[model samples]
Target: MKNFLLLIVLSLYLHSSFAQNLLQPELEAFYNPALRPFYFGVASGDPQPHSVVIWTKIVPENLGLQQIHWEVATDTLLQNVVQSGTGEADSSSAFTLKLVVENLEAGTHYFYRFQHEGRYSPIGRTKTAPEGEVPLLRFAVVSCANFPSGYFNAFGDLARRNDIDAVLHLGDYIYEYGSGGPRKKKKNFSRPHIPNHEILTLQDYRTRYGQYRLDPQLMEAHRLLPFIVIWDDHELANNSNVSGAQNHDPNSEGSWEQRKAIARQVYFEWLPVHDNPQRSIIRSFRYGGLAELWMLDGRLEGRSPQAKGTGDPALPSASRHMLGEKQTEWLLDGMKNSTARWKIMGNQVIFSPLNDSKVFSRDPSIRMDRWDGYPAERSEIFDFFYKNNLRNIIVVTGDVHTSWAFELTGDPLNPSKYNRKTGMGVTGAEFVTPSVSSFNFDEVVPKFVTWEAKRRFCKKKNNPHLRFLDLNHHGYMTLTLTPERAQADWFFVKTLYEVDYRFKQKGGRYIEYDGNQVKKNKKR
Candidate 1:
């Protein structure tokens, strides 16, 4: 420990002048002595049948290129090595290295690690997709990790478990808000945004990612399991579309194009996902004949701006797109051609139509930021599903910061379109995971609204297709897919105020392979 401290002090002394000259003093805070050069730990993602992307970043003591060595093996001891390689890391990518290690066995567990100058990083575990007839698969679906909101107890809980295959992150991984932003100002919480302002430039974004990666629980989760991620509004900005964001100010914040480009560049640099030449995150992963996971890009790739208000004439416009033209075509065609039994979509926002107007008089307009905003496109998709006899479709979504289970149909209210008792006309099922630490309805209006009352009000009479809802609770959902059914189990942590690993299984919903109906499961 003393030697590590001395090394840290020496690295600071050698790089302090260079860091100041670069005007990035905040970046220095991320350098921890214990972790040394590999302060950010390690991560793996985007697993395929024969390949997976392994990532690490080096905090060099000197301003020079780094030679990062990596290896993959079937065991944690790394005795029987399967592949090994060396890569060059430089400042252009903030010293981050993401290499796709290819030519490996399918449906297998592989341990990987990086080395630099004889020092080694933490060993990371990743699994490759299966080729045919997978009987069982599991994933922890999570999103909306606000750093300043509270401790990442949800992540900590998930990290301690070893049952899941991968962590499916549906965006808002790093909130762009600073210390004094709209987030709750709690005196008890010790965590704060490092830069102390909204991230706009490349350095600011990079610093934020560094701060998030420094978290022990998050880093441990990354080290233990491979992640399948997709971005939503907060990755770029709040309520982001292709043209602009609700958080951006044109006059004060400079050009939106520049800021968006910077955010995108920094995101690709920090994450372990492979970058497409066309910059599209719309990709598909086939888990043999059991399931296919289609991760959608709803933020950057040609999303139309939200409707102006409840009375906005463009709310029902067929031209207004959510996944845009190319992505929509790709998704629909892929879903149709897919041979897997379960078509699981890693969605960003609420894909089903949700209207809380009749239940709550104050909240009107049906949440334009979600699929409720693009009624025409949603209807078109539902029509396609119904016409093509698509069954056993499941969507796991995040970004709402609340838990929900909905039976997807064209119109839930119309008895002819959807039968709530039998779930006759349901086209699919959607399972929405709550935030890791973001504020929910309970936190926002704790003074007046009660969780019990709100939950009672959210009944079948109001929202016919709604199966389950948890307005308060910060945790993740575990999704298990098999040949017979796909089940989503919601687990909630006791508190996020402190480091609490204790959690309870609250509820669950499942859909069988025979149909798209959502059925409730008793708590375990």
Candidate 2:
């Protein structure tokens, strides 16, 4: 009898070990293993008073069917479970899981985990928004995470810091170009993307998302915090426009709508987001009594693309809209009605004044893809902010691949605005976070510091309320806010090609037009 019992016990133990080993494969692969119990990590988004969208992906045998189980707990160790449920992983969605967990305890941190097969995933964490008026809010505003150029030291660094309320990811979460996008070392840098070709089909899109999720640093970051994401052109094609894009070939690629849908599906499958396409990403979330975060969708409902030439003749009459009039109206309304101590817009592109003349002769191509290319619209947005008493408003942007702190003036269009000599302010503040592994300005600019100096001079000279511009370095920015002032710190990552997680030491860098300023919580 004893011998028989021991044999049964040994069999059970073996089965358990086999199940545990399943996690290792998901954790290691370049492609997403949906069965891995979130071995890639987990995240939550669109937080409300008592609920948020919980997201995790499950890999199956042949991108077929998958069963995903999720659980939420009140304690970090997941000791006392509060909520639990199961969902079928849609293969069409690349076996992604999105669980909308409601009725969570307000303003509290909760630990979560997903289970499939016999293996349990690593402990995942999330939080619910505060119920009523609360004074302080802390958010980590970040953007531009690319894969090839360097290490995600910034994300790894932020994971260790515990003071942030939520992570605001602006855009450029993934690069879509062939391995030639941007690299730290031109010769020995990137590997051919799994698709090995520009993405245009659903399969290609799914594969790209899978590759990015494999980044350990990204996984760690997702595991640690709730991410709020917005997409820029790279998610579809480079310099993407409403009708078409700079990267898509009319003859080679298929229909634009087909490509766009695939891109959106993959994005929804991979990330933790609220699944409402009709309701624009131009949504707002209030953090207790502290602030209201407005995330914008700058790509979809916009007008025509930027004018082509030095003065892309298109700029003059092309009805090309960046954040269509409706979304822009929504933003203005959010700013006007927001009563939180600080009002923040999770912007995608640069919103400050910029001039091509300030750029050096030997620098990378001056991108007309930013706000600099849309003067009329930019002016209208600024005018709205100025007209309203939107005092502590701050705009955090990504797409530019540089760190910039600008002193936004009331009138953004008035030429010869700033003195180009002093760092001052007018309306609110705008913090432009740098890229993840994108090239730093110094590496590409002819006389790096001189070019930056020219930018500073021209911005200040042409616009008075503008303050800072780095236009170099590849990393993320942390925004901390308080009842007194809102502060943002630019954090630079050491490298990106490898999955190493060491970031350079950082300091408290505040936005110039500061009130209710909050400093970076190094450990948070």
Give the count of colliding residue pairs in each prediction: 0, 42
Residue-wise lDDT of candidate 1 within 47-163, one digit each (tens)?
A: 999999999998776788889999999998999999999999887887889989999999899999999988899888988888898889999999999888888898888888878
lDDT of 2: 0.69
| Model 2: per-residue Cα lDDT over 1-524, one tens digit each | 99999988887786555433322233244544543545456777777879888777755443346787889998888889999988887545656788789888788888888887767777877778885667666777666665656667778877888887788888777777767464336556554555566777766676667777777777878888888888888888888767788888878887887887777777777788888866345678888777888888878777466566455566644255778888888888877877777788888887776554555334413546777667678878766765664567788888867676665663444544433233223555777777776666665555656476546554544544444555555667777776766677777665566655556535455543344222233465
In terms of lDDT, which candidate is strongest? 1
Candidate 1, residue 6: lDDT? 100
Off by over 4 Å in 2: 1-39, 62-65, 183-191, 277-280, 316-318, 360-367, 410-425, 446-459, 462-464, 497-502, 505-524
TM-score of predicted structure 2? 0.85
Q: Candidate 1 at 180: error in angstroms? A: 6.6
lDDT of each: 0.85, 0.69
